[model samples]
Target: MSDVQINKTKLTYDYIIVGGGSTGSTIAGRLGEKSQNSVLLLEEGPRDKSIYIHIPVTYYKTAQGPLLKRYNYQRSAEQTPQHEATMVQAKVLGGGSSVNAMLYLRGNSSDYDDWEKAGAIGWGYHDVIKYFKKSEDNNIFHNKVHGVNGPLGVSDCAYKHNLSRVWLKACQEYGLPYNPDFNSGEQQGCGFYQVTIRNGRRSSASKAYLSNRRDNLSVETGCKVLKLIFEGNRAVAVEFIQNGKKQTAYAKKEIIISAGTFGSPHLLLLSGLGPKEDLEQYGIPVVKDLPQVGQNYQDHIEMSLVYKLKGAFSYDKYKKLQWQAVAGLQFLLFNAGPATSNIIETGAFWWSSQGKKLPDLQLFFLAGAGIEEGKDGVPGGNGCTISITQTRPESVGYIKLQSADPYQQPLIVPNYITAPNDLKTLADGAKLVQSIMSQDAFKDYVESSHVPEKPLESSEDFENFVRNEAYPGLHPCGTCKIGKDELTSVVDPELKVHGIEGLRVADASIMPNVISGNLNAVTIMIGEKAAELILNS
Candidate 1:
């Protein structure tokens, strides 16, 4: 199952792709398609062979299991008291796509348009839509806006809990539109999420892009990249450790870093490509004095509103051993059942009651309670959860190296809710979700409350609840953003490092801003586009 051979420590390739995650796997696959160029992908984690990784419902287990590397991930001490957000960075071949809820969401078009306005020229919605279409193969949604034939499998959830429709109806009652598609450029609506699932199994990045391996590609899992080998200002090679042994890989054309939002910046600092002060503080030599290497961190912050259901309409019935057996049998025999559905199958994107230019808040309606924070345990009876997340935040954070050693975890300060408006927006979102769930359509399903425990008497109480309970939405990005200048960004429009030659970054880490929804689909588009950039270069 391991791709790294102990005897093969030194090698050469046309492209060296670091971090075999969502974007890295895609780029490696595309580059290997023609066999004209050799591509090498190095992943810090093991191969994606775990059964839990393939089951759509076991995503929580993947987060808590050995497959994920949990970091210190502390929040801003100034805003919140003592709390660790515990960011879940996947340690597997397929990366977050292997461990996530598998919701296939492309952020609003304005997300990319805003990117272009913010210095990433040629990355506007119209320019990037082709790449998104190039990677997707939608099974149900057929339109000029969506692709029907592509490598990545995109399908509607096979099974939906009966209560999901009621949830949608409740959203309608709350005045939101009932749009069937969320990825059609317009995102203000409530509907069932089309997921990255195929034939009742998880369709991860590795499954989609690396399943049919090409002879020209070398996928080295369980290999931790130590640093880059720089000749003057050019990154010519990579140094890594595999199976307790040191290894080196040389790239002839270019080295593309796709180690995700946190890992990418961490690797850059380790390779002497960060701020001179930080490199000196850690006793590491500085190759480029890019002060923006680990700055401009942005992420979605969320809080949950839980309610106990009056009937057994939610997936809570599956908690019984008997019901579990039935659902497993159905999945094994027919590739259809509650087991195939990621409980977060339906949600909404809406502006606050006060309205906005774009949908700034997102709601994930889960047909179960205790799913958000698993430690609470499954509800004794039927229950449901409505989680509200702020998609755009004015507050920014940073990532810094804690030590010179690559094994040591970096210091990640998301600095959540530092801006007063950010907090106020989330507080408003909290009230909105509470109101939507309290709609008459959910009258029969409602029983009681848990997180808020009771009605919020005032706006101050809601804001306090949000401040006390909100956590990172796990969509961390902008650590190594793309821009026009080195002083403000890490990568250029072509995704190349600001001052380094033969090096580029192709991951969420290069995103100038965090989008309004899940990040996996856009990350894949980044890979597809990076391949085009490299092949043309």
Candidate 2:
């Protein structure tokens, strides 16, 4: 990537974008295409230069590494006794795209349709598919739903473990049909996932959008924006800290906040654009009293079922020095091996209960257990994991300002599985996965369950397991939702902030509801659509 420093004297630009993440990077690249439009992108984190950020298999390390910022969360008081739950947000130029497993899922088409029905006009499946295609450069499947010449690269996994293939066959033998493409708008059935990897390296938003030198676009990293500088409800500038020095930058035309789900709403609340009572409590003068600014939080929650393997058939064997050396040499020589795999490559989508029109559960089959932090391996040191996720959860939460300090982490409450239906759906999904793993196809490879440790013979067993073991899917969104008015939403259909002039929000935070799949692809699509809206406006 080019290292073009921002001129201290020339701090004004036509468009100023906060947060150089997936959405922010895309907007900067697209808006900079027009030389007349000067765009400035500011990221609080450093540049995406770490080796871990570029490799496909280093996701496990980068996910918990310093490139991410962890925020402590909790369930509501009525749900259970207070316990510590944590969620991580990206803190690099490419955001989650730089650190995530790189799964390229757009969710079921009905997800966008549901967004449209819920007041996000002009955002239905048909309306938003073009944007999804607009940013993609698929190495395979040159069809209407996939794009070929876009900056972001989408390709099939270069390597898959033998056990991963076996899991796919077992899912099919258990009932699901093989799905060739999940991004084709139909997300049901078992299949291998396409990823955001190109040439065996991660195709992060920073590499895709900001790698090329653009004279019109200037990206400044390690700059933490303190607050929006408003002039009579018009956000014209931002005051921030850079290199331990406070600085101010002016926007000639507009300012767009693309700070993801948590940061975006936290920025708004810090800038006095949220609930009047909450702002007053923190001594922040109310600028818009938009009650929905930090409300309507949503996320996907998942629970894993781990099973021991009869032998060293999975990637767990590679933890040894000899196998690690072999795998390293294979990748360095031919760009292939276990190192080329993203680990969570194969997955399936199906209903948690019968007679449901759409699938409410998504399952990911990992070739090795104890791969991710907070997970365990079996006594024999050979195991695999199947994680079941509730795709469309009914539970809602919020993000509130912990204090007036911009550096303080926000109060994040995902309230995961607080809703009765969410718990039931997850329990049902676990049962379905249990049945799939029990199929004869897995008999040669599997031994016994290692997580639940015992057979869950009753509904209560499943429910208790889900409640105790469920974790965040890391797909947080909907804090700054899009809708028709200020009473219920933070931004309008055009993505412009309600009642605030010259300010817009374009990120996953504006999602009316969380999609039924991963958020990275859809978040990039939002950046594509947001740029178009701004250009048209």
RMSD per model, one decimal: 2.3, 2.1
Q: Relative to the true structure, how large is the alpha-carbon lDDT of every model?
A: 0.87, 0.89
Q: Per-residue lDDT tens digits of candidate 1, residues 1-537?
A: 123233455577788999999999999999888677888899999999999899887775786788888877777754555845576778899999998889999899999999999999989999999998889889887677798778888999889888889999999998999988999878988898999988778989999999996778888898988999999999999999999988788888899999989899999999999899999998998999999999999988888888877778788888889998999999899878888988898999988654578888999998887676433533457788888888788889899999999999899988898887788888888888888888999888788786678877698898888788888788889988999999999999999999999999999999999888999999999999999999989
After superposition of all CA atoms, the RMSD between model 2 and the true structure is: 2.1
The weakest ten consecutive residues by lDDT in model 1 span 1-10
Off by over 4 Å in 1: 1-9, 83-85, 353-355, 373-375
Candidate 2 has an lDDT of 0.89
lDDT value, residue 407 of candidate 2 = 88
Clash pairs (backbone) in predicted model 1: none
